[model samples]
Target: MQMEPIAIYLFVSALFILVILKIKTTNSSSKLPPGLWKLPIIGNLHQLAAGGPLIHKVLRDIAKKHGPLVHLQLGHVSTILVSSPEIAKQVMKTHDIVFASRSQPLSAKIISYDSANIGFAPYGDYWRQMRKICVLDLLSTKRVQSFRSLREEEFSGLATLLASHAGSPVNLTQMLHATMLGFTSRAAFGKKYQNQEKFISILCELLKVGTGFNIADFYPSIKWLQDITGLRTKLEKLHLEVDSLLDEIIDDHIADDNNNTSMHEDLVDVLLRVQNDRNYEITRNNIKAVILDMFAAGTDTSATTIDWTMAEMLKNPSALKKAQEEVRRVFSEKGYVDESNFDELKYLRAVIKETLRLHPPAPLLLPRLSRERCVIDGYEIPQKTQVLVNAWTIGRDSRYWEDAECFIAERFLDSSIDFNGNNFEYIPFGAGRRMCPGMSFGLANVELPLALFLYHFDWKLPNGMKHEDLDMSEVYFGVTVRRELNMHVIPIVSKPV
Candidate 1:
């Protein structure tokens, strides 16, 4: 029994190896989807890591070499990556219910109140109830339109600020981020809090950590790895900071309601009003979680879309000129850009669509979990498998798009393809029951800001940089992807508001 420490360690390692081998042997009989050769213990993790930080791009490459539906064993997690629209339809449409639930990663559980929020909640009664509340009360077409005045005010403020900096190099990225934050804060909490900037900064950090690529998420059985990596501690601290802010927000809303001093019912007011209802009984944490969902899901995504659209247009000046011309022409009679005239700016809409096609904010969308083992495309997907639908790859597939790699806004002008998830190849917002429910709200935020920027300013690269020299590289941050570098440009007042 008096063994050396090295002997003990070696014995444990041998046992772990045996267990891994046995598991692999057991699954060998099943008809799993095609996958790259994997090693024991770590599985396909090394391949993914080598491919780079952009998991979608790596997955795309793997799919090209392997098959459309690729099975990857990431540590103890069994994952299925769907690259083509055909397979994506099978997983998201044909067997939607079986894979409707979300894969609860460690960071998501921590930041989203143990997956209580609509965006990450498990598929069940609670998720259904939260989604119903969100669609009906918070994100309905009528509710989004009701916030039109707030959107206009925030964007108009941006136009004014940019106008002041006209002819000077302006950090359009920072301005757009601020504008989105102000709009989201007002829409969600009735007024922008003094700590809104802090909130956004912390949120950005959380997004980076919660990308579902954490070591702990891969090896769930090895719980100590979370602490070893300092991920658990970091997530807890972030959760505390975010939770405290949410608590303060809720307390302010409650105080306002009690005094009857609130002018109108914001999202917080609506959540509080239904807190005690028999049919939709929700706790305070639920309310905080939902409101955080609004900020997390609504803000960065719209901002990223607007950012990418501008970047893409700048990259292709011809598209930029066409979009600008349409924006100015359609809004000329109205004297200012508004959502009402957005319909007439067909080229502008096309530009946005093309941007989305090329660079989806959440390229992989949210990962879905399988509730039951099902056969997809003649291959068996085991129960509890995590599914990643590669929207970025599908959008760029030449089979679906003529010039998939190029930013051609005119391609969408006469095409019937849309991003409503019905068209699987163009599912920028995802598909099925788990599809993004805040589409209207998000689009409102994106369209108005983009139109305003186009209408109020003519942009040029700083230092007389050629448009071709613009860096269009993207940086992936958790669920959303955005420009790698902050866009810097000079704004010349085009049509002074």
Candidate 2:
């Protein structure tokens, strides 16, 4: 007997509805966290649209109404939004292993070579091995410390350029970006490449694309939506262009090995030696992906930190005065600010800490995914639920901080809070197994450049501007967030070489 076509379609549709109904009825026993009432298909998405600010701000506002650990359902995805330190600790430390996996945004999948890199790779042996290599062999304090000469050399070049524009308002954004790129390039690729500008331009474009808060990430069930949205095609094109550049770079290094040139072994050299070993599964693509991570992680983050600290300092004259005085006093005694007396620059350290508290590099700290159903603070977090720790909101929560929004460098003077992930209330670099491996490298880039600029030059805002008049709007990008507007400052050569 031949089945009618209409009957076949109706039977299939009925099965789909029955499955969805079964899911809603069976799994509804678990007590989910506080959230807006869910509606079928697009649960609670309407609540998000009735917004003033989107993304982190929206989530923060939701937390105020719903509580620290609020649950939200968007399409088929289950989300746990964390906005308080106590709950953040419960998620990041108490059940670290359970929530160790990454959510794997669409942008990360394409750009990170299908989540092979450390930044986006799921929780597994691969992430462990990559992190071990990077932390111990590449970004260990010893390794980062060894590159002090390279950092100083790059700092000298930037200071020279800034000194040339003594009385004129100089472009702080461009100079800071260039210096950071120089540091990252020299550290990772053996030398600052001749085409550094072109490379940086591509990097900026990549970060812009990987913002991680787009439609492609939120709705993953419908494949054609991303296609019709054109995000997939655009990212693929960018990835190919970036891959081509890396191809030439790796080939050049391989050819350099063939020639046996006597040169300092940089990070690429270290990875090549590691890849040659048969003990590890370090593929060529792995080396390239890790290299990409180093460049991306190292460059913009340092620049953004410096930009924010400087802006914050300018806004609060007392902060600028105190920080400058500490650096100057140390310089006056030692004749130059070298790494030897790094311990004495307590105030400068405070300024940087305060800046981080207010403006974390990765504000939301990259969403985590739950591997199994778990109870955190009596709230049931379902398996495969996407988790986001609101680092920005937690940092400013009045419960942990006094005058949370104010830029008070001295706030950290007697406080034990640090960004090393040990302090739950202040986790800018995240915590547990998935914490950033390059924390030391990132901090070194920020500290040295910030020290050099403050020690050498006396800065003035454009056209005799008052500190309070300065605009400090931020633009959140892929891995880090930075000021939206460009900063201009006039440099007076205070301490001569």
Candidate 3:
């Protein structure tokens, strides 16, 4: 009476097919917002063609047609794209408590340790505690300032690297990316992986998979396709890469535990000490998750910002000249810029602000999922719905800014408004409780290096390329959005001191 394995497999497959069919048949009604015609199960799959540029732009167009709060079915799931600032405020402010949770994919969950980290964790006590620890212990103003020497050391190296190839057009994007990777990796883990390129490549792959439009994310029934097509394999490779690096780092800490007596600290040291003491319900896995969050969220966002900032500056020479003038005038004859000089670099701050407005690293911010039914700007948003606020469109909204599309740093020179997520008009880092806990650390990472770059090097487009013709087209991979092309700038050493 023993059953054959083939028969059992067939029976399970049949059951799964029936379950999928039943679910598709049951939820076939058009309860969501108005969208293009859809087929059964696939919904808008054909419409969401490759690259997603048309979809990204069309979503805004649809919102304008349907309303500020527009809903579309990706597969079995419901997606709501919010464009108007009014609706964004409702979701992020009025219904903050209900919609603060993250709707991450399974791969994201595994890499992020079941959403235990702040960037991907669900809205609850665990997130609150982890975010608190990150802010107070690791990302505080004092902690960020303490890392000034690291920043200065890295900046000097970057300047020297650029100076070595002064006559040639250097790819600032790639160079800046390496600088940021080194800075964040060392500050977090006390050392950069020897294979910096491999480590970063894995990170890039993870971000790609996490943010890359997958047919399965919108449609639950087709999720098995992700496994069948080796998407899962890629994620596995990335996870193994990240995990191995972290494990090696942890081993190093244990080996050096008895004799290491450095007063100057890094994040790994703090987390290791906390883990050894068995304090605060945090285990080794949780520590790994937080460190992963720090690297993933911290490194890419900062690097993307620097890249975008430089791109924007290159496109607008007037702004670039103004910023350079301010930097050079302030730090004339100084070997290089440092944290102490940041306070006086007013125009540099404005330039970075303008860069953020036009190109927010996290254009949609992180997607927030609702735990309960809520109303955003009089539109009813049901429970378990995904909420997306287009900070990209919001930043370009003409109502809050004059010539919003232009890259003008002077707009902020006399204004008190900032991008700390407080002002609904400009929420680059987001606001409220879920605001990026690492804001200070991120800002310091951006400002000091930016000032030094402008002060030391006069930039120009490569091979007589006109600034007006430079490509501003973007390709969004994940939460981090980047320009479609790597920006190259010729650094003319301006009258050496």
Candidate 4:
């Protein structure tokens, strides 16, 4: 007897469901860590939906009940949320070799050429090579020093833009966004991007799509939603626009032909030269991937932190006043700030560090995938299980800090606790080999410009707006968390000391 089409479809669906359920049951029973209830198709979906800003709060609570290593089934995948610091250290340090692989996301694959870039690439020789390129050639201290002129130029532009809108309410978040993007473009391509504003707008939109929850990510069969809804088309168009911009920059270099081969080269030129040499598996797609990672992760996160730092300072007037006074005192007579002056600006560095403690760009570091079974906190984490460390919550853990929630730049003023991922207690850039390679470069991009802004101008809210009225609500746009309301302040030229 032949079955009807609809009946056959239902039968197949039911069979798949049974198979999945059976697998989940087996996994659940297999001496794995405990977790919240598993709903047949959605498993732990309700928990994620309910857990908001303090997703870690929920995870911590769950871990308390289930033990330190709690396994969660979000959609079709199994994820392990590690809340304890010991477990986090082990995953990031002890077994770094085995757990260094990044979970390959569909969006990251296309943009990063199947994780060829350092930020999301799996642990291997490819990642090692990318790190070498980023460090020795691109993001090294010497390389960053070479880009000082570019930074100074961008800071000048920032000052000019802020001055034009002085004495009136200005959206500083917007200014910082533009400034950080300008810095990245100059460093990466050796020239300021022509369409700076539009470029960032498009890239942010792409980041939203990349990090936003998608049905396709969990249920690939419904991938048609992304395409049918034109979301895919939108991303493709933006990708092409970015491609055109980079291509034009590449063309200019080619046209110049003799564009000073001896001088310090920008990231694009280096990557292109590497591709031409065919020394390794590097390709055009690989270059684009690295560039995209720099923009998506490096630019946005640095800018977001600067914006948050400013907002926090404005909220706490004393901190703002103190930071500005330090800057003015350090460079009272200097016409403009430079990287050399950065060493003397200690308080400004503190402000940036304190801001990161409260709002890490990625509250939860990118999920790590285990290559083999392991035991964490006396609980079993099976192979391929996704692991996420709550850096946001970790930063605020009172067990490790005094007045954890308070933004006191003084805490870092005399301390050696840096964000280069060494001190797990303050890991804005993450820890171990997977740590962010652009930390030094990214930090410099934030500091000098921010110090200059404060030194030159006195910031305040709009007329008739009280400090209490300044909105401090936060919003997460992919990896970077920003103020829900753009920070608007009036920048008044300070009386020269």
Judging by TM-score against the true structure, name the best candidate: 1
Best by lDDT: 1
Candidate 1, residues 77-112: lDDT per residue as tens digits? 999999998998998899999999998888878888
Candidate 2: regions farther than 4 A off: 1-30, 38-40, 49-54, 258-263
Model 1: how far is 322 from its true place, Å?
1.1
lDDT per residue for candidate 4 within 423-461, as digits (tens), equals 777777888878888888888788877887887899878
- Candidates in descending TM-score order: 1, 2, 3, 4
Evaluate residue 165 in candidate 1 and report its C-alpha lDDT on the 0 to 100 scale: 92
Q: Of models 1 and 4, which has the larger TM-score?
A: 1
Q: What are the clashing pairs of model 1?
A: none
Superposed model 3: Cα runs more than 4 Å off: 1-37, 192-198, 221-223, 258-263, 276-279, 333-335, 495-497
TM-score result, candidate 3: 0.88
Model 2: per-residue Cα lDDT over 1-497, one tens digit each: 36687788899999999998989875673478888788887787777877633367788888998899888887778898999999988888999999999997788788788888888899999999988888877788888888888888888888888888998999898899877887888787886666666776886687688664567566788788788878888888988888888777777788888533223568888788778768678888888788888877778888889999999998998888888888888878777777777788899999999999999888888789999999988877889999989999999999888899998888889888887798888988898888988988888888887887888888899898988999898776665778888889888998974
lDDT of the candidates, in the order given: 0.87, 0.83, 0.78, 0.77
Residue 242 deviation, candidate 4, in Å? 3.1
Residue 98, model 3, lDDT: 88
lDDT of 1 at 480: 85
- Give the least accurate 10-residue stretch of model 3, judged by summed lDDT: 26-35
RMSD of 1: 5.8
The TM-score that candidate 1 achieves is 0.92
Clashing residue pairs in all predictions, respectively, total: 0, 0, 1, 0
